[model samples]
Target: MSDDDATGDTATKPGDDRGATYASFVAIGDSFTEGLSDLAPDGTFRGWADLVAEHLAALTPGFRYANLAIRGKVLDQVLEEQVPSAVAMGPALISLCAGNNDLLRPNGDPDALAKRLAKGIRELRATGAEVLLFTGVDPRDSPVIRHARGRFATYYLHIRSLADLYGCRLVDLWSMQGLRDWRAWNPDRLHLNETGHRLVAAKVLTALDVPDAGEWHKTWPLPTAPTASRTENARWAREHLLPWLGRRLRGTSSGDGLPPKRPNLTEWP
Candidate 1:
């Protein structure tokens, strides 16, 4: 379906609770799935996957969760390192969100990225897990990443297609109007902030036919003043954009030495 066509209601109705159906959930991908920017007090990222898992755990006794996602992981790395382990765990639910790191690379190919993503999804599905996929939020709000808006859109379209082909539930972030707001993003203008992650968790649950408090897409209160002024934009470029570009040029990644937060399918803390 076209992006516009796909922009109807969320995957499931409001107030529909289906959390009990899932006994376990494993999230795999890059920093986004690893929960960057949505940091915990102990200096760890706890993104939407953890939030969703917490809700699911509350509903089902002995619910297990694992997040095998590491920062800066490309699609190939995810397939090689994380996917196999996630499949071995045999969780009833799996959420995969990768390729943003690849998309940010110079001259990245969306089609090739989509193929890799599809392969991982298919492999996960082979384990009889209900896979969850995501279309990235539009990055146009960021001055730096906005240069590749066209490429990002193409990648998102491919992701939508893959979700359809695999019968995976999709958390269509591309169509979520709330994400377009700059406030939804972290200072790095890459990862989503705490509020943004919360919204994503709600959407993912809704996609899974789970019940939630019913306010994932609510618009933020209007900013009293303009946001992302020239000075702030310049600061962002210096602080976030330049470092990221340096990493890319040096052929390094943020996840260089970082291990997966929850390497095993264990009880949610």
Candidate 2:
């Protein structure tokens, strides 16, 4: 298990999707899950969902990901569509990063929203998947989005309660990254860029207890200012976690003895 291979630690776990391994992963959410406005089709996991998958693949080996996230899905959509798919997969791990759209969509009934979301979570967990739930991020200020100032605290509570009732791991990204910086947001302010995504990934890994989680969070720096330069973003990705993630997927290695570490950007160069 070396950093060079970046994936040697869990590269061939028993449940990995490849071969006979039964381990499969599914993501459930809205546009954020859809990787909206993300630079590439591959980067469609514009936020933490993709990052979590990337890290889990390293630890679980042969792990396969089935992103069931859809655009503009609210609580109802999740219960109707995403939840059923995830339940059928019987995934080893399920990440539920949703509910932002429920808050933004017009005429959403909060009580009904909570009820449906809870049911969706209950069903996912019933399939024996270890559920990892994520809280929503604050919307970036935008002209087209009319209700930017709407209260979202209730959604957070509902999500947290569901996770607790289901006995699942919860990553409060809204608290960890969202409330901390306006800079962490993209220009559109709706989704995350590379650094934002990396931070979220680091948080998720820490929750999962993969060995390298600590290093990923502690070593990475966060920049006080957002970078408009895609080059800088690309460079950061190449130098850290993203490159290692690439190596693992390709079955390559860094040749070093260290485990592949997640990159953080709390204080980036």
Best by lDDT: 1
* C-alpha lDDT of residue 96 in model 2: 78
lDDT of 1 at 260: 97
lDDT of 1: 0.83
Off by over 4 Å in 1: 1-20
Candidate 1, residues 1-269, lDDT tens digits: the string is: 44333333233222223454688999999988988899877787888888899999877889999999999999899999999999999999989888888888877888778766766877887787888899988877767778898888999888877677667888999889998897888898888899899998998888887866346886789899879788988898899889988999999998998999999999876
lDDT of each: 0.83, 0.57
Candidate 2, RMSD to the unseen true structure: 15.4
lDDT accuracy of residue 100 in candidate 1: 86
Clash count, one per candidate: 1, 16
Candidate 1, poorest ten consecutive residues by summed lDDT:
8-17
Q: For model 2, how does the per-residue alpha-carbon lDDT over 128-169 read when each residue is reduced to its tens digit?
A: 677778876544433323364354656666667666655777
Taking all chains together, each candidate's TM-score versus the true structure is 0.90, 0.65
